[model samples]
Target: MILYPAIDLKDGKAVRLLRGDMDKATVFNDDPAAQALEFVAAGCEWLHLVDLNGAFAGEPVNAAAVEAILSQSKTPAQLGGGIRDMATIERWLDKGLARVILGTVAVENPALVREAAAAFPGKIAVGIDARDGRVATKGWAEVTDVDAVELAKSYEDAGVAAIIYTDINRDGAMQGPNIEATAALARAVTIPVIASGGVSSLKDLKDLRDCGAALNGAISGRALYDGALDLKEALKALAG
Candidate 1:
């Protein structure tokens, strides 16, 4: 499993939001590109980035920051937030984003997901952020009754690269990931599932690795920033 270091952008700075709350953000780095290079130097295989401002505004709010990271690092990065259209999707992919994650659009306009997945082929991923097992969208500001598993299964043949499953309640809480829920979702579909949110320690990474489900990998944020989890140690642990 790949340990994807997360770089969440808020107001052009790298920050982490507790439980997806905008008001509860903690800025970690001012230069996101330098941060990406640091993670790359630390041996992270992939980088997971989110545009907090873009997710709320429905457009690329942190494009400059994202572009900077892309230019600085050769490591493949996947990004989510404020990408709800074909043009934006194409723009990001054209500018070197290895993959583009569709969240709100996956819930609001699933056809776009299908179209993008088919058009890009192994470059489109669906980010299913859920609370209490129901999918949340628009940066987790709105909750829906849509069942997470069913939605994932619906896209079973959509040719999506992966499903990034995040549990909102645990995000940035340092409580650990929802292993059972994430494993179940992975087992329910053929497309790869990447667990996100929480992911507090090396044990959590080990737990996810040994969860017995065919998960693609996992994404983590605050813990790495706060030193609760050492990047080199966690990477080595997962390497086993």
Candidate 2:
């Protein structure tokens, strides 16, 4: 399983929230590019970035911060949040993002997901943020009755590179990822699935890896920032 170090951008700063709560954000660093460099230095293969402000606004709000990280890092970064249109998707990909993750669009306009995947191939991915097995849109502020597994199955033929599954309840809580649910989603879809949310420790990564072995990668945020999971050790564990 691939270990993706998460850099969540809130007001142009790297911050982590408690269970996806915006008011509970804890600023980790002011320089997101520097933080990305640190993760690269520690041996991260890919970087995961989210625009917290953009998610709520339904548009790109942290372009400058994301550009800075892209400018400085040699590592490939996949980004999500407020990337709802094809123009924005093309813009980010043109700006040199390794991949663009479409979350809200996946639930809202799935045809665009298929179109982008066909046009860009591996450059497109689907981000599914769920609260209690129901997919959430607009940055987890809105929950739908859509079953997570059903959503994953809907895009099976879309040719997306991967499905990033995030459990909002476990996110930033350091309680560990929803391995059972994530693994179940992975099994339900032919496309690759990357587990996210509440990845708090080395054990959590291991558990996620075991669960998502048939999947692609795992995303970690507060765990790495809070010293609960050492990036180097997690990398080694995932490699092993």
Candidate 3:
């Protein structure tokens, strides 16, 4: 499974938020582009970026920081947040984003997800952030009655490149991923599922890898920043 080092942007700085709480954000790096370079140097194949402010604002608030990272690194990156419309999707893709993950729109306007997937093929992905198995949107500010698995299955034929499943409750808590739920979601869908949130160690990575279901990859933020998960060691372990 691919390990995606996360660079969540809040006010143009790299930060990690606890349980999706914006008020509890802890800044990691002031120079996000430099952080991207550091991750690339550590042998990360892909980077995961989230525009924390943009997600709540419904517009690309950290565009400059994202562009800086893109310009500095050759590693292909996938980005989510503030990307709601076709024009915004097209703009980010043209600006060097390898993939565009549609989150809130996936629940509110699935037709757009279908249209974008049709238009961009493998460049589109669905991000399902959940609390208690119910999908959350608008940067986790609102929770919906949508079942994560059912929503994932709904996009089975949409040609979505992957489904990024994040369990918000465990996020940044260093508790480890919800392996059972993530694995089940992966099993229930033919489309690849990338696990996100609460990934705290190499063992966690191994568990996800050996979970008996095919996971596309996993995304981690706080663990890497706090030295809970050594990126170099984790990459070596995953490589094995």
RMSD of each: 0.6, 0.9, 0.5
Q: Candidate 2 on 25-114: residue-level lDDT in tens?
A: 999999999999999999999999999999999999999999999999979999999999999999999999999999998989999999
Angstrom error at residue 27, model 2: 0.1
- Score every model by TM-score: 0.99, 0.98, 0.99
The regions of model 2 sitting more than 4 angstroms off are none
Report how far off residue 91 is in candidate 1 (Å).
Answer: 0.3
Candidate 1: Cα lDDT at 67: 100
Worst 10 residues of 3 by lDDT: 231-240
Ranking according to lDDT, highest score first: 3, 1, 2
Error of 1 at 187 (Å): 0.8
lDDT of 3 at 118: 100
Q: Which clashing pairs does model 1 show?
A: none
* Candidate 1 wrongly placed segments (more than 4 Å): none
Please give the range of 10 consecutive residues that has the lowest summed lDDT in model 2. 206-215
Compose the digit string of candidate 1's lDDT tens values, residues 1-240. 999999999999999999999999999999999999989999999999999999999999999999999999999999999999999999999999999999999999999999999999999999999999999999999999999999999999899999999999999999999999999999999999999999999989989999999788999899989999999999888887
The deviation in Å at residue 113 for candidate 2 is 0.7
At residue 117, candidate 3 shows an lDDT of: 99
Encode model 3's per-residue lDDT on 1-240: one tens digit a residue: 999999999999999999999999999999999999999999999999999999999989999999999999989999999899999999999999999999999999999999999999899999999999999999999999999999999999999999999999999999999999999999999999999989999899999999999998999999999999999999999888
lDDT of each: 0.96, 0.93, 0.96
